[model samples]
Target: MFRLAHISDPHLGPLPEATAWQLANKRIFGYVNWRRNRKGVLTTDILDNLITDMQEHAPDHLAVTGDLVNLALPAEIANARRWLTSLGAPEDVSVIPGNHDAYVPNARMKAEEAWRPFMSGDIVHSGSLNFPYLRVRGKIAIIGVNSARATLPLMATGYFRKAQARALSKLLDDCKEEGLFRVVLIHHPPLKHSTHWHKRLIGASRFRKTLRKHGAELVLHGHTHLLTKAATEGPHGPIPVICVPSASQGLGSRSKPPARYNLFEIGGKDGNWQCRLIERGYSTEDKVISELGNQMLSVPNA
Candidate 1:
């Protein structure tokens, strides 16, 4: 069995001091918001403990959906690189970007430079880093797509362009032919109405259409900071789309759940793949991490 661990939206804390010029644009909003609302909630200690517990499980691979930094400051981006190294080697962990990682124009470029190793594909077609990259791990095909982009102030939107859609379609078909379990990773929830209009993923309809045309075994994302289970249409049937709570969120939040992560045990063969989902994280009643839920997502046909 291949054990894959999923985590997202760490929003790594202790926001570094930023210059006036750095905070002059959309990052100003994120800076203020982090100080007033998120500073106390998303703590490093919480994330550290959670990571410790997750490492104990020793998953075959780790998928970080996005939002590794808070303000996308240069220092924050660098710190995130160190944190990713601590998590594991680039070969063992795959990452995609989130809206917060691209809080300002060209900030995503900085993040990409720092995080290229963790998000890079096995083979580069154009000799440059591009989204919708494919990485094969055992029988699994991990496809990383970039949905996060810098938006106007007060907006936290993501975009899924037609270019990526076309690339993703081809990747899905190729992986299917190879009899690999395709796991598509994006930062934003792709289903319609999954998030607020100001934060929704543009071109979601086209994205869904591509998925319906060329199905994947599973889709993982993290932007809502809520534990969500939803499905979209696929050629074979319904495809499972899952979102885990922020990896840095603390308890006592009125709206959002505490930090959590998921473990998926993928087994079986081409015609009868079996998957088991195990949810683990903190709760309102305790600080210790424990198993919250375990159930079969896909079962072998009789």
Candidate 2:
């Protein structure tokens, strides 16, 4: 069985000291948000403990959906790189950026430089990184799409442009021909109602149409910071769209739920695959990572 672990929206905190110039644009708003709300809820120690617990299960590979940093400050970007390296080698882990990574106009470029290893795909494109990239591990083909892009203040929308959506359709078709368990990874859910209007993924209809046309075994996403499970119609059956909460959430006097991650045990042949999803989250009461629930995820043709 391929043990795949999924986590998202760490939003690693402490908000590394920002220069006045750095906080000049959208970052000023982000800084305030971090200081007022996110700072108390998320912490580096919480994230560290969560990673240690996640590695305890010995997952074959890890998929981080996005939001590795907040404010997109230079120090924050640098620290996020270190965190990613400590998590695992590039080949053993896959990542996609979040809106926070592109908080500012040119922050995305800096993030790309720092996170190239984790985001690089097998087939390289010229100039800059392209979406719909593939990484074949065993019989599973991990497909990552970049929806993270710079947006106006107070907006965290993701983009799936016409070009990327078309390329993704082709990639999904190719993976189907090869009989691989395709898992689509993105920072934002593909469905329209998955998030608020200001934080929705643009061109969601096009994305769903591609999947409904081609078909995939599973779809993993983040960005809403909620533990959610929904489905979209595929050619064969309903595609499992799973989302996890922030990985660094701390439970306080009246705080939110603790950090969580999903472990998927995938096996069986291409058309006859089986996946067992285990939702595990940190228990503040016990100070341990315990299983919240376990169920058999619906395979394409189970």
Candidate 3:
């Protein structure tokens, strides 16, 4: 039982040319703030009903915790690399880089040139510290952090770069603490007690003192598009800070209403290690948005 999927901030847009000052930041005016309020701004029919409700919930591993695009628009990151290649075959899928995809402090090489065609062969350019990258698979250890840089105009701040917190403390001490389920994908929100102060994450208390000195049990994130709950006392303990919302919303406005995705299921029981949260259900009759039970557990994890 190793399934996990948690989408976030799919701000793909109807780009025509908005010189990427975060599309003229009226709090990130994506698609001109959904034409002044709310209407699913860049609708490929709501990203084809969230890629047909995530290929009918076939989540073995998919975590896109970032604003795919709204204005770091090299054509909205090439339509967010065709919405992450229609949600599949990018080695299942795993992405990171929020804060409007680094609005041009060299835009992290323009988000690897519009996400290198849906992360061609899982782009892990570990220039050692630039944007914190590490991706293991077997027992699962994904640590992709690059809280998208380039700030100041209206200042939506974020930064986790104490050499990516010591390269996430040597990739969580070389992941194999007997069980191996150290998933730490970050797109900002490394603790602000639920962010604010002009949108926090600037060193967030040195990233919560390096997640209490490397004991990440799972610290997934997505910039406060919403659905946020926080925690942080982790030396292999209480550290569940999962946030998910904005799978496709220029401004259909949901501080925490719908647009969901957070399914996980880790294993290794008796020896002590478990996880939950698989709730994915959304239907719209003929308009169709179905996803029912991939081993249901609608939220049970302190």
The residue ranges of model 3 lying beyond 4 angstroms of the native Cα positions read 1-5, 10-64, 68-101, 104-144, 147-169, 178-180, 186-258, 269-279, 284-302
**Local distance difference test scores for all models:** 0.92, 0.88, 0.66
TM-score result, candidate 2: 0.96
Best first by lDDT, ranked: 1, 2, 3
The residue pairs that clash in candidate 1, if any, are none
**Candidates 2 and 3 compared by TM-score, better number:** 2
Model 3, global lDDT = 0.66
Could you tell me every candidate's TM-score relative to the true structure?
0.97, 0.96, 0.34
Q: Write the per-residue lDDT of candidate 3 for residues 118-213, one digit (tens) a residue.
A: 333234454323456666666777777777777766566787767878877877777745347777888878775677776688887887888787
Model 2, residue 106: C-alpha shift (Å): 1.5
Ranking by TM-score: 1, 2, 3
Count clashing pairs, candidate 2.
0
The ten-residue window of minimal lDDT in model 2 covers 250-259
Best by lDDT: 1
